[model samples]
Target: MKPVADATPKVTKSEREWRDELTPAEYHVLREAGTEPAWTGEYVDTKTVGVYQCRACGAELFRSETKFDSHCGWPSFFSPLAEDRVILREDRSLGMVRTEVLCATCHSHLGHVFEGEGYPTPTDQRYCINSISLTLVSESDQG
Candidate 1:
């Protein structure tokens, strides 16, 4: 699928560099478009307020205020930190069609975004992201 264009400068890296930087699990998810087992993610039940960054490129992608408990196992967000912060593309993998989310800066696979699910959130969209794909910088860390 073609990536959604944004004005943010891109971050390009070699395969070996990515492999060297990320752990096996992180690489699989962020670089290989892999999904972690449901309920196995670190941010599934997290309640801390923080900014969520792309694990691959350290780009701020989602804010803690946008996160919500969707009970879908993965960490869900109603929206990204900014529309330009992520790229959404149509995914046709695994014989199912879904919107694939990627970090705009590095084009790293973050996860999928589901819409019109009747969620009480303002956007009514659930960004079902893998926790392994993100790193949270809690409020305290910003101090």
Candidate 2:
């Protein structure tokens, strides 16, 4: 895994242009640190095979095979496609300290990363991702 650098978010015109092309929901959650209501996101119950990519920069983030029903009212992934593709920040808001995760490529706020401690997986990292932060590419479409 590469070291996490304080990489200034790549906010090129092309990235902004891509963002502008997305719907309001996508922009709010992916760019504005907003959350979609429970079970309302397109990927919440989606069982199709695909890869989820950043909506802003098209960077591969999560694999469909790793996604599971977290029942936390959001899309959950055991791990990101690449360790360096996401950056973890310490969130000290809401009167609590939680790990906030963001996309490294474009610095889009994906959601929070928590330890799945005591449940399963030794690493026990649960990346609770917002569905709007991603754009799904079906396996068929990738060919």
Candidate 3:
């Protein structure tokens, strides 16, 4: 695994400056650590064929083919395109034990990952991701 420094986001601005650039919701979810309502995220029911990337740095995270309807009210992917693109941190917030996933490049809060529950994949892992933390890159962008 890469060192935490390589995955931790570097703050390039003052607190006030960051607040000014990102919306309250974005800052809350990406900076202050908050979550959006499940199933209400923009990508939950989206059928657009594309790649899901980190919103902050546009790093390719997951492909549409790996997405599945886990009925968990969140965008769930069987696995990430690159294991290095995301860093898993042990999150013990809200009195619950969960593995939180963050962007390796920016350390922006993505969501939590869960295992088991008979997922289609052999790993039985479900990466429950937040739509707000991602940007869908259309196929045309690959050119």
Candidate 4:
């Protein structure tokens, strides 16, 4: 069996610190584990080539090559840039059980992931991420 992912985060900060660091919307999604409205995220329809990093802490999470349009009203990725960069936990909110994706470094909530959706992705999984929780670094801007 595959080893269980680590639950400990590399960075820790108080709620007030996070609030001061992030914008209201970003704090809602990243710290409070909230979801953005459907089709309303900045990255939902973006097709740029680059990497998406955690908004709370600049940690590379997903690559542009892994992104795909799932029409699920959020940015979707087949997989994370690296497994260790993300942490998955069982979320049982809103009367549903789902896997919650978080930044491993900061433990900020990025979004939820669903599997067995029959997408053409290599992993057949969809990581529905919130645009507010991510900041894209376009290929041209990468140094």
Better of 1 and 2 by TM-score: 1
Clashes of 3: 1
Backbone clashes, candidate 1: 0
lDDT of 3 by residue, 31-87 (tens): 676888987899998877889988766678899988888999989988888787788
The order by descending lDDT is 1, 4, 3, 2
Candidate 2 wrongly placed segments (more than 4 Å): 1-5, 11-19
* Candidate 3 residue runs with Cα over 4 Å from true position: 1-6, 10-14, 141-143
Q: Estimate candidate 1's alpha-carbon lDDT, on a 0 to 1 scale.
A: 0.92
Tens-digit lDDT track of model 1 for 1-143: 23465444489989999999999999999999999999999999999999999998899999999999999999999999998889988889989989999999998999999998999999889999999999999999999
Per-model C-alpha lDDT, please?
0.92, 0.79, 0.80, 0.91
Residue runs of model 4 more than 4 Å from their true location after superposition: 1-6
| Poorly placed runs, candidate 1 (over 4 Å) | 1-9
Instruction: Compute the lDDT for candidate 2.
Output: 0.79
**Which is the leading candidate under lDDT?**
1
Please report, as a residue range, the 10-residue window in candidate 1 with the lowest summed lDDT: 1-10
Residue 78 shift from truth in candidate 4, angstroms? 0.3
Tens-digit lDDT track of model 4 for 3-76:
24666678899999999999999999999999999999999999999999999999999999999989999999
Q: Which residue pairs show backbone clashes in model 4?
A: none
Give the TM-score of each candidate. 0.94, 0.85, 0.86, 0.95
The best candidate in terms of TM-score: 4
**C-alpha lDDT of candidate 3 relative to the true structure:** 0.80
Candidate 4 TM-score over all chains jointly: 0.95
